[model samples]
Target: MSNYKPIDAKREEFRKYLEHAGVMDALTKVLVSLYEETEKPEDALEYVRKHLGGITESSSNTDALRKELDESQAQVTELKAKLAKFETEAGNE
Candidate 1:
């Protein structure tokens, strides 16, 4: 005895499409690589994005993000120093 709905049939068709397109094999390789990692990535989505190959965001975009992060960190450090100075001046008053 078995029960299968139209959704199940559609899902089966989609699976076949993926298999035909070699998506399943590509996915399997990425999963295996993830499983074999001695220290798993903090960002699994990024890891998968990298392993899936070629569909990456431009290096220029990543560079821009990195530059923004560095600038933000520098601002934080400057703010911390100013706060520390203010606290010291307040305490002395």
Candidate 2:
């Protein structure tokens, strides 16, 4: 019976952590939105996935990031080439 106190404290601490992290609020909002829906979605899990910000949205963002990465790489290569050219000219002088 005495051992139960530590377990209860640990559970409460975890609950507080989740609340501080905004997880509890996000969940409450998602649940409220789900409850408020008029025509219930057939696949509840999919609905939850969409409400929580779907993976598809992030995947779409990858395309733009990849383009930026490629452009940055090209810029780095151009700068390195210029640096090498300047160093070679300085050495000759």
Candidate 3:
């Protein structure tokens, strides 16, 4: 039949259509961002919307910086405890 085609051929045509629509690039970026997230978003659609809506990088950077600051603060607390223990031991000696 003239209308018959292999599944791979149909898939290739669909891929071409998505590429032509610029969806391939946008989808790739969104997927990469999603994959790199340390804290997976609760609302997947909202995350995708914010990313696709041309929101600036500042928001993402802010999130990363905040997480870094929290981790640093925790490390400082641990170091402080270790220092306190060392001081106590030296005082006993």
Candidate 4:
């Protein structure tokens, strides 16, 4: 059904968002380690941001990413519920 397409798309988008989150988390860890070792958080942050394009001087990107990550997670949960319902119905038929 047409409705299924949107769910599928959202699921795929959520997967991408999770992947991005994982990458961001890794970068954060790496930056933290560098900062601790070098005693220069600003330098480490700058290096990390430079290596990972799309991170601007402002915190807007971080906020947006967090929001998108949360939205994606919720969408994935909804998609899973829909999938379970569809599977149950199919099994009953």
Give the Cα lDDT of each candidate: 0.88, 0.85, 0.88, 0.73
TM, every model: 0.50, 0.53, 0.45, 0.40
Q: Mark the 10 consecutive residues where model 4 has the least summed lDDT.
A: 49-58
Off by over 4 Å in 4: 1-57
Clashes of 4: 0
Q: Per-residue CA lDDT of candidate 2, range 49-81, in tens?
A: 777774236756877889999999999999999
RMSD of 2: 6.1
Q: Write the per-residue lDDT of candidate 3 for residues 6-92, one digit (tens) a residue.
A: 679889999999999889898889888988999999998888988876544667787898999999999999999999999999999
Prediction 4 TM-score vs. true: 0.40
* Sequence-dependent TM-score of model 2: 0.53
Report the C-alpha lDDT of model 1 over 1-93, residue by residue, as the tens digit. Answer: 679655788899999999999999889888889989999999998999887873346667888989999999999999999999999999999
Clashing pairs in 3: none
Which parts of model 1 have CA positions greater than 4 angstroms off? 1-7, 54-93
| Candidate 2 residue 2 C-alpha distance from true site, Å | 19
- Local error of candidate 3 at residue 79 (angstroms): 68
